[model samples]
Target chain A: MSQKSFVWFCLLPLAVVTTAFFLLPMARLVVAGAEGPHGLAGYLAILTEARYRATLINTVLLAAATTVVTLIVATIAGMFLQRHRFPGRAVLIAMLTFPLAFPGVVVGFMIILLAGRQGLIGDLSNRIFGEKFVFAYSIYGLFLGYLYFSIPRVILTIMAAVQKLDVGLEEAARSLGASPWAVQRDVVLPALAPAFVASGAIAFATAMGAFGTAFTLATNIDVLPMLIYTEFTLAANFATSAALSVGLGLITWLILALARSFSGSAVAAAG
Target chain B: MSTAGHGAAVRIEACGKTFADGTRALDPATLDIARGETLVLLGPSGCGKTTMLRIIAGLELPDVGGKVLFDGKDMTSVPIERRNVGMVFQSYALFPNMTVADNIAYGLKIRGVARGERAARVAELVALTNITGLENRRIDQLSGGQRQRVALARAVAIRPGILLLDEPLTALDAALRDRLRSELNRLLRALGITTIYVTHDQAEAMELGDRIVVMRKGAIAQIGTPREVYFAPKDRFVAEFIGAANIVEAPVENGVLILPGGRLPIECGATTANATVMIRPETIRVTEAGEGILSGIVDSVSFIGDRQRLVVSDASSKPLNVDAPNTIQARIGDRIGLSIAPDAVRLLPSEPRD
Candidate 1:
């Protein structure tokens, strides 16, 4: 075959997959969002309706919180792990990243096993404080589950970034009369800003779209994913769920873009 | 610049470094650097020169009984930040996420200098390092030489008591390295900070050092002025390392040194046993065949811009390297006579075995 034809042939698989699996489903979802009882207004119900709007806000807040807390925890842990050497460190890192292989449902179940009504936290709290404390089926439980999985993904990126850091930079900062804290705040953190954005985006997007964890711990949770699940399966409200899915994807992408541009400007200012 | 003449006098006494991995990077040694002196730790790689610099910089602690005194104050336990030293890394570890102005102002800002004062200091340093009009430029946008200048400016902006440079010019290309070497030498003189420079390049050591401490295998080999070290090396290693020296292993009979081509008189050095003599290439003059004390067959000639280097065999056990004048007309396989002053032949203390 000619070179031009060979290039087109190489692209044939990607083109077919995108058209069949992505473009068609996305087009169908958009159409279905509009074909409800209220026509195109069904799509706007994601913002106009009280229940959908509240759930969307809740989901965005949870994802944002998870992303921020995960970045902080992961950055600290990763920096410590990358810089120090001790026995059992390899085992500790392996255990920390062990959650990366876990599905969202497994994470949700693990959260419940620790904080459910009949779980470890409740038993311990009942024995110690004479009052059972339980929070597995609420938004907090889902938040915990999101964090458990998100931390593993974020920490690995942070560790790699910390490893790539020049020890000389820290020494130089210290030589310049910067204290230890100043070294981290000025030199270390600014150098790792790109890594934070890259990994934080993944955590945010995952939390925003995650369904299994919310579904498994769905008693008092009202996240976008849980709402979409019930609207599609329980209430048979296909149009509303389809609209919510599109909104969820757009909001996650928008937030990640905003975050990237903010950090980009920050890096620009530093550079 | 008022801090020029009164920098710290650093004395490292019995300082040695044995890393946790059991690698003895430095042997216990003592040295005193005078206030405003430029001391260079010159050595090849893995020669413990950087280890000694780090001990002075307080980046690395010495073994037990080690003491570092700065102007009579014991500062062995002080960290690098509290040590009040300025360090320039080989990699030129300029903060990439900062403007050149911000980087230079970093140390001043850390010491709580006011914004206006910081800006003024940065401007002065920017001018001092010849990096004018680069205040707002990011580190990534700089050339290698520019980054080196920025690093120096940042280190000097705080008016540090001592300046530590670890192979600061090793990262640049040859032409740029040569240019920066002289510039750095002038800057060191102008600033007059008690400086500890580490480098493997002997030319850099010669140009920048008030006194050069030649190190080998984690121990101090010799310490003297560049001219002293070059003319009066203590051993075979220092003689061969500093510059091109043809090591002639011959017997000293009375005051004369016996060689394969001819015998030359020597004033001081190994008098009894077999003597290991060092003859500098530039010191050996090329005379007509049979006219001088020694004659040899020309092996090869290398024209080095200003001078031509001729390798003459039969002068000694090894081929003698002669840096004759560029005007001399000599070629491969030509007979050349060599002449040298008695003072030019340095008899090293150590005698090499056959």
Candidate 2:
């Protein structure tokens, strides 16, 4: 065989696997989404139905909040961790990133151990205020769990970007009569913009589709993932569930694509 | 455009920088720079030249009891931002996010200058630095030389009292470095600002500095004009650092230095039985074999365009380097005589060899 034919033959396994496991399933899911009693309107029902619409809005808002909060917390912590050297710093970083090894279910369990009924916070509140305070089963608990896992991913990216920062830029800014805040605003943040866009997109996508944590928490949660889970298992509404699944994936993918395009244009204009 | 020279006389007293890890970057040294004078800290790498410049620029705080004064005002505790000093780094740290005009005008914007005034200042600096058409270009779009001009323009746009540059030309290629060195020298002279430049290149120190501070191993070895440092070096280190010098250690009897090749008269003050002396390569003239004050066989000859450098052995304990006129013809292993003026031989105090 010729060189190009040999290369194509080498890619035969990957092509077969992708078509069998990926394209076929995606095509089936799309067709199944339209095979229900509502037919083609099922996709529109995701936006027109009040219950589905509310759940979609809730998931988007949660993902956005997670991304914003993760970025802010990770940036500060990452800058400090990357810049300063002290005893136990390596250990601290190891502990912070230890969450990367955990699945979302484990993160949810840890949040429950901290804030669930009969958990640490509940026990302490019961002893101090004669009333138990618990929030582990609520959206607040899910938000906290998402933040727990999102922080490690975002912080690692931010720290890497921070390490590559040129100290001369900061010194130049200060020499140009910029205050500390102004230096960060003008130089450091702009330099780290690509990192933010990359890591924030990951954080947003992860929060948007995080199912294991919501599963281990409450079943009544109004997130799209939980909603789809209920519609698929409890209601056995395959068409609506598949449609909602497509909607969730498309929405998350659309937001990420938007972010990438915006950041891409920004980088081009910066140059 | 405003061209009112706002140079400030800077004085650093007893400034020493001992890093957190107990490494002494700079020894306690005191020096003063006159208004509108360009003082260069010249030394090898890790010789505390950059540390000294940082102390003066307020980027690094000196150890206790050290003070930096501007026009006799104590500025020891002042930070770099409040010190009103402009700094150009070796990396030419122009903000990559800002256009050239925006980078030049950033300082004015920080100072809350009016938009119209900031534009005028940016225009003046762009013209001054000869980067007028690059105003809208981002830093990454510019070449190394253009980035350097943008960095200088950004630093000077604020009308700072003192300019501190740290090896600004070391990042460029050789040809560009030489060209920019002369251009930068002219620019510094035109600005007439009290500037402190740091570089390991002796040629740069000679070309740009009015007074060069030769440093070594965290200490100031000598401080003088380029000519003074080159011709009348205070010690063997400065003599070897500023230019090529042949150090000959020999016994001095009466007024003549006893060498293996021949005895040469010394005009320097009374010397010990064993004396150390410095002879510049250019000072030793090549003549007929055995005709001048010293005679030896040529070991090697290198033709260096303007001058031919000859290494003559058997003339001293170590081989002597002689820079002869290019017109003079010499071959290896040929006997050659070298002429040296007594005044050109400088006696250096014997520093115990480590």
Candidate 3:
């Protein structure tokens, strides 16, 4: 056999395994949900019900907030690490990316230990303000938990982009009478726009689909994933749970599509 | 149009640059660039020419002791934004996010120029660079030559006091490089801007420089007009670098240098008993044995379009190259007489050969 054919033969099994384990299941779920009794109406329930609607809106809002906060923190950290050679820079970089390895539930538990009522920061705030301060189950608390995972992802993505950027552009801008801020705004930021959009999309998608952290911290909130879990376990309604799952999938697809459209243009502009 | 004669507008006094990692990229170097004149910094790779240009643009700071003066003002501490200088990079570095017009107007906008003024200036520069209809096109939409023109327009749009170009045409193809080199010279002359151009290409330096500064590893080798640097090189390195030269060892006796295979009369006042002889290929002429001072046999002959390159071997088998017009017919095995004009041969300082 030819070398090219031999290489294709070697890759065939892995491709089949991926298709069987991942793509087939996703296709089955999509097809089953579309052919269900209520058809597309079951997916529309997420947009029609006030509780589900608010939860969907809140999920999008929280994802956007997480993306924005993550982008700011990550961009600053990435630029600093790229341009400076401070002491312990490697240690700081490694520490920043450490959260990416931690499971979502572990991050949620750690946040609870630090910021929950009667926890470390909670006790300190209680002593300082003379009142019990609670953030463990709050929406803001969920945001903090989401950020623990999102920030590191954003940082790693942006750091790669920043490191690969040609520094001559900044020099050219500065020599053309651009201040440092103007250089960052007009040259650096525009060059980093693709990374910003890509990391923001990934962070938002991760936050939206987050299950373990949201379940551990904000159990009271009815995000689509949590509502589906509740429908299947608490209410023992398999069809409704499947329908809610379908709705969540559709929302994720729409979000991804929107992100793709926006980021594609941003990438084109940057290139 | 302003008719002021071109003269020195920027002076670099003992400028030096050492990076944080202790790499002395630029040693103490001083230069004066004339107003409305093009000064080309010619050097090999890592010769600190780009660093000097960067120092002039205020993109890099000179370490320890150095002063950059523009228009007789000590601008050592002035920020790049307030320095009012423009730069073109080797990679062009056009703003990919903006259209051609926006890239040209970026400096004007940063200086808070009015909308009407910025638009007018962008239009004027676009027209000047011959990219009039491409103002609304994005950077990626333009070809390589178009992008280079846009970069030039962007740098000159604000009428900066000093324009610095760092190997601007090095990224272009050969044919395009030649075209853009002449176009750039025309544009800079029309603008009458004080420009410092840096390139490692000797041909580019010779064609574009009003005065050329030849630099070697972190130091200035020689600074002079193109004719001075090329014809009268100060050292062996400068002589061999600017163009092809035949370097021969010779002994200076009775005002006539005795080469290994031939004797050439030279007039350089050399106190040393021995000196090196430098002769360009074009300076040597080939004729019959009785008509020329030295005789040799033609070892190789090759046609190079408009000229025929002849390599002649003397009694010692030392090969000397002579370039003649294409019409001169000399076969490889033919006997030839080579003679160099006494005035053409230069006696260089006897030093350890590089």
Q: Top model by lDDT, which number?
A: 2
Going through the candidates in order, their DockQ values are 0.73, 0.71, 0.74
Name the best candidate (by DockQ): 3
In candidate 2, how many Å is residue B111 off?
Answer: 0.6
Superposed model 3: Cα runs more than 4 Å off: A1-40, B1-8, B269-272, B315-317
Candidate models: Cα lDDT each: 0.91, 0.93, 0.83
Error of 2 at A176 (Å): 0.7
TM-score of chain A of 3: 0.91
lDDT of each residue in A1-271, candidate 1, tens digit only: 9999999999999999999999999999999988889988887888899988898898899999999999999999999999899999999999999998998889989988999988899999999999989999898998899999899899999999988888999999999999999999999999888888889999999999988888887645888877888889989989888988888888888988889898996656443
- List the candidates' TM-scores in order: 0.98, 0.96, 0.94
Tens digit of lDDT per residue, candidate 1, span B93-198?
A: 9998889999999999999999999998888888889999999998889999999999999998888899999999999999999999999998999998999999
lDDT of 2 by residue, A142-252 (tens): 999999989999999999999999999999999999999999999899888889999999999999999999888899989999999999999999999999999999999
Which stretches in model 2 have alpha-carbon errors above 4 Å?
A: A1-13, A127-130, A268-271, B1-4, B269-271
The list of candidate 1 runs beyond 4 A from truth reads A267-271, B269-273, B351-354
Ranking by lDDT: 2, 1, 3
Summarize candidate 3's per-residue lDDT along A1-271 as a digit string, tens digits.
Answer: 9999999999999999999997897777666555546776766767887887898888889888999999998899888888889899999989989998998898889888988876788898888998767787777878898888999888888889998888878877786778888999998988898888778888988888888887887667656677778877898766566766767767777887887787776578887
lDDT of 3 by residue, B207-297 (tens): 8899999999999999999999988999899998998888777567777777555666777645456678778899888777656777778
| Candidate 3 docking band | medium
